[model samples]
Target: MKNIIIAIAFFFLSYTNAQDKKIYALEFYSWVGANDNISYEMASIIFDSNLDSNDYYCNNKEYNALIRVKYSEKGVEKIFDYNAYVNILYLDNQTEIQNKNGAFYTMIIDGYAPAKLIKGNGSYNPDNFVVSGIVTKNTPRILNAYHLDDAEFLQQNIKNASVKPEYINTTDEGRAKIKKFFSSTDEMYRLLMLYIANFD
Candidate 1:
């Protein structure tokens, strides 16, 4: 009886360890309009057990989330060393999980302004660009923001999908033109879900 009890405990411990060793998949998808000129890329970052030990930095206090990710693009695979701000949404219901299946977490990364370029000679040049994206266990949809405020503006007005190109321009006059064109965040979200659904 003693030997049987020890074996059962060992089996239970092994099963628990196996369950704890889960690895989540991170996927990415990007869309650029014909008229939109933006260059950006996304990578999954895995951090040490402690969240604060990574290299990536997040300005927002609430967004300091990191995980281990195996990022693959164009037939190339690489691991990220830094940490970044990510919002994770956990699906509780099995129906919800199956509805948008396979994704265990949803992460959103916002872009900021005042882009800079480093030359091989160690010289820095001015390159003003912003890249932002929404990531999930299966897909990440990235987009370029015209200016520093573009991402914030889009998030604030996500319900109003009539965003015009002029509004994204980095100018006071352009900001005023935002009302002229509206775009739907729900629509964009649906499109993203569709992309993931079709992905193999």
Candidate 2:
């Protein structure tokens, strides 16, 4: 009995050792711009190819980019491997994924993922963890999006809170009141963009 148990354990260990998992590096880039003007986007990911079906990582789709990196940064010398998952969104150009700049549709990567099977629950989930918002062309020096830190946000909110709250409206009367200040029509665009008070 003891010998049989030892043999089984050894076999399990051997099988586990045989399964070699490869961690591939992926460079997810996109065109970071609004309408006409556009720029490049960069964000790296050391993916542990553990998923059973990871065909998406390979150069199987248009978004799957086989990037041959030549430059080196910090210590992680750019892994000249197949990188992709850039143009996930098919907004305008469906035929073309990307041209000289970037991709057609940028995947909205946020913190969310699909969970394990919930037995009876069929709908399951469609949320995953992903933070690619600031994955712009440049680093902190020149961030693509305008982001306010907690400290800065608190400071501004506190300062504004001290003063009597002035709520602006977007209706005709509100626009008329705002226009009476002898201001430009461009300011009307800012009517909807408002800053709320700090929640208790």
Candidate 3:
């Protein structure tokens, strides 16, 4: 009886620790026609589902996007949902960051179809989705945002039933334009790109 009781206590403690883990998500958000003076909201909410870029991909590319963080604090949860750019998430903890080899993580905000770089203190798993482009209605609201590749700048809208991105037809020039479209000179930005592309 004592052994069984002790085992139950240990399991309870383990589960509680997992539920109250201290973690945060770093979300990269951006809009083509926005500036640095944009304002956002701080919200606390949860959802039933979470997905990645593979579930909804158009093409492969990167972009310089604004950041929003969703995390758990003192047993409470909070999130930031903003305009479209390319969602690349990094989910990690301070201890893991110090121990792991620059390991990052990935996750979507659940509600938005856009990809997110979810930074949480969970594990050393890396992001595999390559977000292209996402355009919004000049507002930072998530619902108004459109996942471009429905990609950032990959697929184009046409009334005609043409599958695949327009760039598929013209190889050189189209690819060049895509490169320029998602170009970033920032050192950290480039590093994040590397992490998102291939870091297992």
> In TM-score terms, which candidate is top?
1
Error of 2 at 3 (Å): 12
Q: Which ten residues in a row have the lowest lDDT in candidate 3?
A: 158-167
Per-residue accuracy of model 3 over 1-200 as CA lDDT, tens digit each: 99999988986775564344322212233332112222222221121123334522222322223333343534544333333234334333435434243323332322333434333333211111232223223111122222222223244531111111222223344333323223353222333343334312
lDDT of 1 at 36: 34
Return the top candidate by lDDT: 1
Ranking by lDDT: 1, 3, 2
Write candidate 2's Cα lDDT for 88-191 as tens digits: 33234423323323323233222113332212223222211122222123221111221112233366542211111122333444444333331342221232
C-alpha RMSD in Å of predicted model 1 compared with the true structure: 19.1
- List TM-scores for all candidates, in order: 0.28, 0.20, 0.17
TM-score of 3: 0.17
Q: What is the model-wide C-alpha lDDT for candidate 2?
A: 0.29
| TM-score, cand. 1 | 0.28
